[model samples]
Target: MEKAKVYYTDMHTTFRENLLQKIQRLMKSAGIETIDFDKKYVAIKIHFGEPGNLAYLRPNYAKAVADVIKSLGGRPFLTDCNTLYVGRRKNALDHIDAAYENGYSPFSTGCHVIIADGLKGTDEAYVPVPDGEYVKEAKIGRAIMDADIVISLNHFKGHEATGFGGAIKNLGMGCGSRAGKMEMHNAGKPYVKESKCIGCGSCIRNCAHSAITITDKKASINTDKCLGCGRCVGVCPVDAIKTLNDESNDILNCKMAEYTAAVIRNRPNFHISLVIDVSPYCDCHAENDTPIVPDVGMFASFDPVALDRACADAVNNQPVTPGSRLDISEHIHGDHFCDSHPETNWKTQLSHAEKLGLGTQEYELIKI
Candidate 1:
């Protein structure tokens, strides 16, 4: 495969042109307009920051992308699947509320926010992964799968598990339904936390495999009967049930790459990642630490893999911010993501993505 084109723009803005305008220019330069969006449903996939974690991309960037889609005669909506873990975005109602509270309302982004998987994170489309190894069929959120086009508006940052959250991570793990996410993150079934369970019987009712049973007003999952659908993880009103998260980092990255492949396989997709507020952890966490590095900039590409590669390279080339997490860490693995997360090797995701025919890791960076 030839080198993929990844366009980039610095964070330097003057009086006339601000960062927002720069993003618009960057997307156009990256060929976002080339995609025919006439009356099609465009899913602008984004992470509406978990309330209190301010590292997430602002609604302004989403609006810029949505506005461009609208101009091309497309119907666009900002969308994301419910998170598998316990958080404000675990269900559609709370997810929407959190999104609105975080200022991603239709009033802010010029489009509606749809929780991709339905009310309880169970609604999904079983998408077959082409040439998949770890995953055969990916359980993706129904709304995201129903879209005519997928545009990932990603916030690039370091991650604890996958090493970094970029285009691949955004589309793969971010788009999975509750069951799908569990499959990628864990090798074992979920166990109920008795301290948090209120004996609501919500989990027992939602489990189709008859894997859950209640004893003494608490829930217990029968691991033998459990299929690990993760529905019980979402239905617990008090956030009692939890995933085992026993997958190794390499396996986790590979599974995420497969999931990413499942998401964009046969769809028209575009990717953009903003490398600002380079947090050491994901926005899923309620607290965000200081940036590990100074703000890099915005990047866009038709190829998600190349886009991520370019962003990761850009961060690796930059000087670490003083007093940040990167500065505090003593180990230098020659890669910032790996250095920040010593247990993880970020290359696994890109290499696996390349093997899956997603996009080449080699990219021609065009600075605009």
Candidate 2:
């Protein structure tokens, strides 16, 4: 495979130019304008940091991307799918509120925020994967799938499960509907916490597979019958039902790549990643620790695999921040992400993505 081009710019700001302007400049240099945007509906996928976690990207950066899309004659909307976990972003209403609370309002990003999956996280589109080994069809958020073009504006950082969350993480795991996430993270089954079940029967009512049965006013999920569509998890008012996060991190990474392929395949796509706030954990966390490394610059590319590889290389080259998790963790492996997460092997995602013909890990870093 040919080496992909990954554009980069340092985190240097002059009195005449700010980071936001630099982002716009980088995107232009990366050729985001090359896509036909006339009357196109563009999905700018981004994470609206879990409420209380300040590690996510600022709204201004999104505006920079959205503004560019509009300038190219496209209709852009900031979008993200609901979380599979119990959090402020688990459903559309709460997800939008969290986004607003985190400053992704229309007034801030110059575009409206849309929870890709509908109110209950049940609205989805099953798109077939070309050469899928783990996933046959990826359940993607309806709103994202409806878009004519896809743009990922990612906050690149460390992840416990996957060595790092980069462009693929944003588009892959981030784009999956609740059920799709279950398929990626588990073998399609969930257990009910009887103590937490209030006999509300929300799960029973939502279970299309008749996998859930209410006994003694408590819910019991039959693993044999359960399809793991994850609808029960979405409707359970008390959050008593939860999917087992039992997939190996390597499998999780590969599934994430496959899900991402289901999203961007046959669609015009672009990517941007800001490697700031280099947190040692996902932004899905409610609280953020000090950055593991000094803030690296921003990156943009048409090839997500190369973009992630470039960003990871940049972070690994930086000195660990004092008093941060990377500073405290025993640095056995030279790779900072591996040092931070000893059990995880992030290379699996990139290699699998490359195998799927998503993009090559080999890249030419073009500085703007």
Cα displacement (Å) at residue 261, model 2? 0.4
Clashes of 1: 0
- lDDT of candidate 1 over 220-305, digit per residue (tens): 99999998888888777888998888999999999999999888888799999999999999999998999988999899999999
Clash totals in order: 0, 0
Model 1 superposed RMSD (Cα): 1.3
TM values, all candidates:
0.97, 0.98
Model 1 stretches astray by more than 4 angstroms:
none
TM-score of 1: 0.97
Question: Whole-model lDDT, candidate 1?
Answer: 0.93
Question: Model 2, which residues run further than 4 Å from truth?
Answer: none
